[model samples]
Target: MRIFDVAEITRNIKEMCIEANYSLTEDMVSVIREAAKNEESPLGRRILNQLDENMKIAGEDQVPICQDTGMAVIFMDIGQEVHWEGGFLEDAIQEGVRQGYQEGFLRKSVVGDPFGRVNTGDNTPAVIHYQIVPGDSVRITVAPKGFGSENMSRIFMLKPADGVEGVKNAVISAVKDAGPNACPPVVVGVGIGGTFEKCALLAKRALTRPVDQRSGIASIRELEQELLEKINRTGIGPGGLGGTTTALAVNIETYPTHIAGLPVAVNMCCHVNRHAVRVL
Candidate 1:
């Protein structure tokens, strides 16, 4: 078994927090560019261009792309053969977020409590998810999800007979309801099947995927394409100013579910789509 240092993990998470906030991923950038190219609305094309410029400026200036730095959400794929040393893994991750947000001068958006509503101060206690996989290496992805789009996300438990059409309608309805509130040119992550919580997680995970990549499953891939087309037809456009580029991409992730229940969750992400990764 390979032993890994917790300090190393913390250091990487710190960098990821800063970098993800300051830069937009290439995949997201490419999607925005293409969206701009195909956008029929003059205002939509302009908004997309401005968005690209904002990202470029953020990277060049080493500043956040948006004012809302967002809550730190991390996903870890830990190899069963790997052992962590130096300290508690969760603590290390939280420490990293605290340092990154503090040092980078990022906005501290996380609250200490759900109802009491007090600031976490340093965005500590990051939301982290782990999956055990086969190798000795560990892969961590830090995705800073903003609330504007996240709040617009929806989930539905449909009857098995509701089927594909139900999912399609739900997605369209969610996007339509979201409208300008989600900031438009959003990324839609649909999680089908699984339990309620699992489906929600799958949706969040889906947003971390590369915008241009499709599922390996042919049926799922086709559905993603179909959803993207239909979502764009909503004419939410960039900044919800009205255009054909309502969504930059539609990603779907599915899992086995109970025979009687069809659970679906949608996670919305704004144009920024900030995430970073490290592997060791």
Candidate 2:
């Protein structure tokens, strides 16, 4: 069995939080660059160009790409064969976030209470999703999700009879309603099947998938391509002014579900879909 220290987890998480806020993965950057080059509308092209420059500045200056900074969302894939040493794992994860926000000088956006509106001071107690998989390595993904696009996300509880067409319509309607609000040229993460909550998780997880890649499932890949085409055709443009490059990519994830239920969720993310991955 592989022996892992909780302190190491803290150190890595801290660095990841800072890194993710500073820059996006190469796949994401390339896609936006390609979009700007191919964009038909002059205004859309300009907006995409501005976006690229802003990202460049953020990385060069070691600053956040967007002011929101976002609440840290951690996905931990822990191996069953691994054994933890030192302090509690959960506390270490939270400490990592706390230290990252404090040391990184990132804006603190998380609140301790929903209605009270008190700041957490440090962005502690990140929304962590843990999964046990084969092997003895830990895979960590830190995704700082800003609220602008997240607020525009939607979930649909359709009948199994509603089928694929219904799913397409629901996602399209959500984007139409979102319009410029989701911070156009968004990457859409879609989850099909599973329970209500599971579907939402799936949608959020889908966003972490590399933007340049498609779902391995044949039907899902086709759906992803079709959705990307349809969304761009909406004329929402880059800054939502008007154009053909409304969305950068459409990623879909699926899971088995009950016969009576067809749960679908759309998790919207803006141009700065910030995330960083590391394995230990």
Candidate 3:
């Protein structure tokens, strides 16, 4: 089996942290541009243009697109054939986040405690998820999740009979409840059919998928499109100024579940939607 160095992982994570915060992905950029053109409200179109300019400026200056640089959330897919060397994988990832935030001048938003909260100083102890697969290569994804939209996320337990219509209403209700606070023109990630925790995770994973990419499953793809249309019709608009461009995309990820229960989660992400991935 091939041996991989934790230092290598650390190095990559550092760069990813900086890059994701500063650079809006190409797919996201293209989608926003299209949204601007299609936005029904004059104010909505103008807001989208301003957002585009903001992205351009951030990239050119190599500065964070948002002041809330966000808590570091990492996802790793490690090949079973590979062995780790050099240091503990968990520590290495946190070190990478620390160095990235310090050196890149990204804000440190993570806290040490939930109730009696204080800054973690370096944004240490990243929220990391690991998965094992068949190959020798490792894939790492860094997604900085700001709290604005995160705070608006919700999970619902629906009866098995609730089905598609229930899922639709729950999603719409969550967005409506969020109003402008979660940041309009948001990306909605819907996780369905899994257990309580798994469903929440499915929603988070959904956000990592490219906004333009639809699920391979035909029925799921149709549902995504339907949800997108209905969410935009809410008229939350750009920056919540009142318009037809409330949400940019709706993504759904599902898993097999028990016969008696249906769990659904809605994870909201603002237009920034910052995420970066690397494989080694």
Candidate 4:
């Protein structure tokens, strides 16, 4: 067994929080750049160009790409053979978020209470998910989810009879209704066939996958491509000005479900689908 220092987790998370806010992954950047070129509408193409320029400036200036710095969502895959030391792991993670937001000058958008609506002061208590695996190394993924697109996400509990066609319609309808509000030129993360909450989590996790990457499962890959094509055809376009570049990608994840139920969740993310990944 190997000893792991929880302090390292804290240090990495702090840097990751700052990194994710300042820039997007190369795959995401490349896709957006390509979209700008192929965009059929002048306005859409112009909006994409502005987005590209914004990304460039954010990196150079060390500023967040979006005003909403977002609530931190962290996913961790921990190794079973590892032992943690140096303090409570949970506290360390929260401290990392607090420090990152304060030091990096990223906006603190997390509220302490749902209804009372007071700011959390330092963006503490991130939404964290943990998983155990066989390896000795830990993998961390930080996704800063902006509410502009998050608020438009949806979950549909379709009867098993609804099948594949219904799944497609549910996703399409969500995108149609979201329109500009979801920050068109979106990345759609879809979860199909699981319990209600599980599907939502799956959908959220799907966003962490590279936009250009498709599911390894052949059928799911086809569905992803088809959904992406249909979503782009919706004419939502970049910045919702109406064009052919509505969505950048559609990523889907699936798990086995109950015989009687088919739960589907659609998690919407803006063009700035921000996430940073690291391993230790």
Candidate 5:
């Protein structure tokens, strides 16, 4: 069995939190550059250029790419053979978030209550999801989600009769309705076939996949491509200005479900898709 020290985990998580907010991942940057090349609208190309500039400035200045630094959403794959030493794993993760945000100068956005909404100083308490997997390494992914795009997310349970076309239509409609609200040129993550809650989970999980990786399932892969084409065809462009690059990509993830239901969920991310991952 391998033992991982809590202090090392905390330190790595803190560094990841700060780095993720401050810099755009190279893969994401490459995808956006490619999208900008194919974008036909003059304004759309201009917007993409500005986004590139923004990312560059953020990195060079060591500042967050977006004003809303976002709530820290962490996903952990814990190896069964690895034992955590020194502290509770969750507390260590939260402490990492608190120190990262405080020292990085990232904005604090989490609230104590869903309704009363008291600011939770330090952004303590990250939203963490854990899964057990084989091996001795722990893999951590941190995705910081800003409110603009997250607020426009949606989930629906449709009859199985709705089928693939139904799922496609629902996603298209969701993006159409989201319109300017989701901050255009977004990444769309779709989860299908699971229970209502599982579908939502899948949708978020889809976001963890690399932007360029194609879905392994042929049908779902086709759907992802179609959705990407259709969403960009919406002309939502960057920051909602009219253009052909409304969405950079569409990702779909699926799982088996009951015979009677087709649950679908969509999670959106703005141009600044802030996420980082580490394996230890």
Candidate 6:
């Protein structure tokens, strides 16, 4: 078994936090460029251009692309054969977030209480999800979700009879209701066929997929394509200025669910779609 230092994990997470906020991934940049080409509205194309510019500036300056640097969401896949040689894994991850935000000058967005809404100055204590697999390496994905889009997320419990059409309609409605608020030219992640909470988790999981990657399931992929086309047709455009580029992509992740119930969740993300992954 290979033993990995916790300090290394901490440092990597810190770097990921900064890099993800500052740099727009290549796949995402390509999606924005392609969206600009296909955009029918002049304003939409302009918005896409501005987004591209924003990304370039952020990279060149080594700063966050958006003011709302977002809550630190970390996903970890730890190899069972690998042993952590340092302190608590979760604590190390949180420390990474704290140091990264401080060192990178990224905004601190996390709060201490839901109702009280006390600010956590350092953005410590990230929302961490962990899984164990068979290898000797650990893979971590950091996704910083801006509040604008995240606030508009939704979930619904559909009867099994609602079927595929129901799921599609729910997603469309969520996007429509979100309107310009969730930030147009967005990526829509749909989680289906799981328990209520699991559906939400899966929806967030869908957001981690590379922008150009297609779902493995043919039916789900077709659904994703259909949703993408329909959302863009809404003319929400970039920054909600009314154009043909309302959404850049739609991704769906699914799992088996109860026979009597069908749960669906939609997680919305802005064009920034900031995420980074590292393996050690």
Q: How many residue pairs clash (N, CA or C atoms closer than 3 angstroms) in each of the candidate models, in the order given?
A: 0, 0, 0, 0, 0, 1
Off by over 4 Å in 4: none
TM-score of each: 0.98, 0.99, 0.99, 0.99, 0.98, 0.98
The true-versus-predicted C-alpha distance at residue 225 of model 6, in Å, is 0.8
Give the 10-residue window scoring lowest on summed lDDT in candidate 3. 116-125
- After superposition, the stretches of candidate 2 with alpha carbons farther than 4 Å from their true spots are none
Compose the digit string of candidate 4's lDDT tens values, residues 1-280: 8898889999999999999999999999999999999999999989999999999999888879998889999998999988999998889888899999999999999889999999889987799999999989999999999999999999999999999999999999999999999888999999998899999999999999999899999999999999999998988889889999989999999999999999999999999999999989
- List CA RMSD, all candidates: 0.8, 0.7, 0.8, 0.7, 1.0, 1.0
Superposition-based RMSD of candidate 6 using all C-alpha atoms, in angstroms:
1.0
lDDT assessment of candidate 4: 0.94
lDDT scores of the candidates, listed in order: 0.92, 0.94, 0.93, 0.94, 0.89, 0.90
Q: Which pairs, if any, clash in model 1?
A: none
Of candidate 2, the 10-residue stretch with the lowest lDDT total is 117-126
Mind giving the per-residue lDDT tens digits that candidate 1 earns over 209-278? 9998999899999999999999988778889999999998899999999989999999998998889988
**Tens digits of lDDT, candidate 2, 1-280:** 9999999999999999999998889999999999999999999999999999999999788888998889999999999999999989999999999999889989899999999989989977699999999999999999999999999999999999999999999999998888999998999999999999999999999999999999999999999999999999999999899999999999999999998999999999998988999999
* Model 6 Cα lDDT, one tens digit per residue, 1-280: 9998899989999999999999988899999998888888888788889888999999788768998989999999999999887798888899999999999999998889989988889997788889999999899999988989998899999999999989989998999888889888889989998798999999999999997999999988898999988887877788888988888889999999998999999999998898999888
Question: Clashes in model 5: which pairs?
Answer: none
Candidate 4 to truth, TM: 0.99
In candidate 1 the C-alpha lDDT for residue 54 amounts to: 89
RMSD of 1: 0.8
Model 6: lDDT of residue 8: 92
Error of 2 at 222 (Å): 0.5
Candidate 3 or 2, higher lDDT: 2
Give the higher-TM-score candidate: 2 or 6. Answer: 2
* Alpha-carbon lDDT of model 2: 0.94
